[model samples]
Target: MTEIWNILFNPLPNAIMTLLTGMSLVYWLFTMLLGDGFEMGTDADIQFEGADVQDVDMDADTQADLETEQHVEPSFFSKAMDFIYVGKAPMMVLVTLFKFISWIVTIASSLVLNLAAFGWKSVLILIPVFILSFFLLHYVAIPFVKLYKNVGYAGEEAHEFIGRLGKMRSTIQGEQLGAIEVVINLDVIRLNVKSKDGSLLSYGDDVIVTNQDPNKKFYIVQKDINLNNI
Candidate 1:
């Protein structure tokens, strides 16, 4: 085990993989130990029937994933992520699998080539390892995506967001566009938004949707007080 850890941390590519996978392990450990008290991916809780927004714990990395969800630019990059079932399962989970697979491939290839740690042969080893990781990631994630859907997670249409209460994913002021997180049907969704009155809305500030732009440019929002807090 000591020799294994040494090799994993020595090579450049393997080192990166080890770091990412190590973080994933820590995240999963926290998720397991804390149970329902700690939800790594629950962005914002919403009560649609009574119309209320509630505070939920979320880490920075998961929040970043939600912020960019369904909003990635450049069709190719977006399509590539979709190809690997990114939206179906948690992005971080897929990322963890990708890195671990890459690390395994790199280490195995290095052994086959008799490449020394931090050696030139290990440098060449990265070429095929990087490519193989993607294919493996694509196949390995299939079961996870199905399992995620088994939990009844489904995204709703944008029109359903009107009159919904949510929290700001980023600061929005005046005409500048930003993101707001809302929950519907047990799925967290982020939509482009702008403060209705040109006021500054910072992250985690409660907001309610007033209306949506005619052309679907963005949602018009304003500060909202959570009734549950009163």
Candidate 2:
């Protein structure tokens, strides 16, 4: 046990990789509990400031940089990132996979080579390890990339939910959010919703979608009106 711990932390390469791997583990734990709340979006968001950008305090250099950024072509580094399928999967997914692979390779090589004596010189080994990790990530991310492309990103069509009729999947009252199960064409759409009128509605109540919040975070709903009463 002492030998393993000593080898892992005493060496610079293993220690750096271990720290990255531990951080990745914490990231995955949070993701599992809160979904991909931290994912950097599947698409690139590179945008140059346009006419709409407020220019009240914008300096000449900042404007020049933005203009230059607009026409700048993709560099080899960006293309290489795409080639490795990094942008297709969740950024952290690729990062975690790469860090884990690097950690394992470093530890295994350390065990066989007694690399602990190398000290800071061992950090040089990370270059090759990084290359190998990305190679592995490319293959691992292929299927997932294909799947996300086909499924499309979530909430792409939330606008369709307005005026839809659905049944409460859980009790809701006042401003409390709850799940409502609706069918859009053939697919079941369950979403978090709040009562439009602060009315008490139970799990089995039928409801109609009224409107959406400005931010589109959740839908506003009210109890479905029965025509028989009128």
Candidate 3:
């Protein structure tokens, strides 16, 4: 038994042992901070009613009633993932935080291992380990995190009116600091608009534009009172 323990734990090749210890410590710290092997999938909760498998000749009314109750519930995980990649969470913050924590653990482990073994030469082995960990964490882990966010757990119907025109729900002004809700392709989209005439437009206004310019990142809207009068 003692021989087995010695063989398993013995630092026969001191350099390899130091590298293994550092790597193990890094894995422990990463899992403890981030999560258990980074979740990379999304799932959605859906509910269905009137699923009568036994009744082959079901009434049309009952079948229609069942269809009415069937609905899909969007998953929170998909939204969170979208926010990470498509939204505004900066990549620098994600990379820097993980790197900082990993480095702290690596450095501390190297010190502890050297102290226990009473060897000055073991310190040299840590340089390669640190470099490898840094590269893996930055290039590999960071990209995986972004990919998980982009792919999402479940699929989402693409917003069809992202590039179409929409009627402004409220007055859009040059300096106004609020969003406008527009109905496009039967979907409501909230967008920011800027005024080209340096004037404030009223609610139920029509905003027409061929393209969005840097000067007016929102919209340069014009009033369509004829449509509103109806």
Considering every candidate listed, which one attains the maximal lDDT? Answer: 1
User: Given candidate 2, what's the lDDT at residue 189?
Assistant: 41
For each candidate, the alpha-carbon lDDT, in order, equals 0.64, 0.62, 0.41
| Candidate 2 structure quality by residue, lDDT tens digits, 33-115 | 88755442333222111101111112366446434533334457645766765423445556677788889988877777777
Per-model TM-score on C-alpha atoms: 0.51, 0.47, 0.27
**What is the C-alpha local distance difference test score of candidate 1?**
0.64
Q: In angstroms, how far off is 94's CA in candidate 1?
A: 1.0
Error of 2 at 171 (Å): 53
Predicted candidate 1 versus true structure: per-residue lDDT over 1-230, tens digit per residue: 99977788766666766787788888778867876322323233432222212112233654475455424243465457557865455566677788888878877776676666446446767777878888889998898777654442224222267788987767656666666667664455556677898997777788999887775546789999667645
Select the stronger candidate by lDDT from 1 and 2. Answer: 1
The better-scoring model by TM-score among 1 and 3 is: 1
Off by over 4 Å in 2: 35-74, 154-230
lDDT of 2 at 223: 89
lDDT of 2 at 211: 80
Which parts of model 3 have CA positions greater than 4 angstroms off? 1-165, 225-230
